[model samples]
Target: MIVAGFACLGPLVILGEYSASMLTNQWPPTLPLAVLAVIQAALLTLLHRPLTAIMETRPAQAIVFFLGSRLMSVYLWHVPAIVLLTGVQLLWWPMPDPGTGAWWLSRPIFVVAVLLVVWAISTVTKRWESPQPILSPRWPSDAVTVIAVALFVFQSLAISSYGLDLPLAVLGLVCTAIAVVLTGGSSNVRAPDVPSSTAEAMPPSPR
Candidate 1:
């Protein structure tokens, strides 16, 4: 299945590029794009078992858990890290022209710099990502949870629509805080136990 997934990659890349070109030319090749997405998903389905097996190993489990713990921080801070790095670079030195050999060569260094910045940011912000102790015993009702989610989605859309200016940022923060508070508290429910096995230590798949 993994071999089949790899084999599909060549055709997938070709079709993807062709679809991209069509979109770039202001011609929406919807069918081709949809086919590409389906094929990509199928490839992932094919590769899933083998990838899961690989990730079940101890070393892989360790790496996965370490990153998984701070996954949200990594996602949220990476773009800001890139922007910060680019600004610092602009202050210190002129940027190489895009598509130049120098520009290509600098990509690895830039990526490493971004990762470092993200790591630093994650150290401070990871506490937020970690599961916090419930402050109240009252669990929120389903209706309240839905409303909190709706408010969060609305605020997120508002931020995206009106750019992340100071007011919107504050509004987003307020909305997110409210959502968290609304959803916060303890319940009698408990998570299911994993069976004792080498694979049990690994985090559950994101799928």
Candidate 2:
């Protein structure tokens, strides 16, 4: 359904029915947006069983675990990697007609290049996305910090949107860097120490 939503997104944007600003400036959700949300929820609910079943299988579970490890890296780098490689491809090869066999065949090269770039980047930043919790103060704070960091990272990422906006891209890079620093520091923050006097001040428990 995510893919379906993305497929429909372009048309809606082209029709001037939606824009990122609507997400920010619009206070209450419009009927159309609400309906779309409901439809998306229903689609996910329908797919839940099949998705759960796939995860239950050992081989699929292993594949999932592997993918989850580098999911952040892949998501972050794929857009830029594809865009970079696509430009190079356009220069190197004659343009193929859209939806043609030649165009379809050419895609794997871009996909491979993206994957390679993602893997290379993972070596540097994968620790930030590690499942292993660093010595944060408490689980709650750590979780909130992680979520904030992830959200920032997501906003800082590129999806090969429209024309390249160098200023926005640079802003995103700076934001992502800030997230990385926050994440790293928060992960190591120790919980506040309880004094021995405070422990002793508590009423005695009944034996």
Candidate 3:
């Protein structure tokens, strides 16, 4: 659906071929799509086994909240953070902008930063919901902090160096190593167990 939506607006993005037009026009078949999405969501909500299974996964809730919180966080403070960081960088390093030819650098930095931010949000949320109560107060675990900081620094370097920063890539790999060490393995964040009644309604595998 998303791809189809984008495809409907592909001509606008390709540029030079189409005249400037209002961005709102890009929302092709908006009413129908919106109606379909709502209907799908409503139908899914009404389904028994699938909906129950969905609610049973801790990771699903964690992901939904993680993304929601991160988006809200960005909405709350991104402008201020950007302005403050830009000021600091300008005053301290005074780096020149990477020209159009090397503009590909911007995308990786953006990608890394958004990924790190989302990871941070997910980690913190998992920590908050940890089965161990005492550890909850120590929210946003050291592992999350270390990884987020390392990724941010690597992204900043990549942004400054126009995709030619070998050290940044190495640092990213090192962060991955540290994450393994800290978590011992991947965090198995699952939603709390579903009721037995919900489970009973699910179709059984064929014997």
**Highest TM-score, which number?**
1
lDDT of 1 by residue, 62-123 (tens): 99999999899999989889889999999999999976999999999999999999999999
lDDT-better candidate, 1 vs 2: 1
What local lDDT score does residue 115 receive in model 2, on the 0 to 100 scale? Answer: 84
Candidate 1's C-alpha runs over 4 A off are 1-36, 141-143, 158-171, 185-207
* Per-residue accuracy of model 2 over 1-207 as CA lDDT, tens digit each: 666765665665566445454442133554446546766887889899999988899999899887888888888777777778778878997869866998898778767777887788887878878867545344335665776677585653442332236776676767667776665545555455779999799889779
TM-score of each: 0.62, 0.53, 0.31
Off by over 4 Å in 3: 1-4, 14-55, 66-71, 89-101, 110-207
> Which candidate leads the pack in lDDT?
1
Question: Candidate 1, after superposition: displacement of residue 71 in Å?
Answer: 0.7
Cα lDDT tens digits for candidate 3, 52-137: 78868998888777566556555544544555555755687644564553456554664555555545555555544434644322
> RMSD per prediction, one decimal?
10.2, 7.9, 18.1
Q: Which stretches of candidate 2 lie over 4 Å from their true place?
A: 1-39, 97-105, 116-128, 131-164, 179-190, 193-207
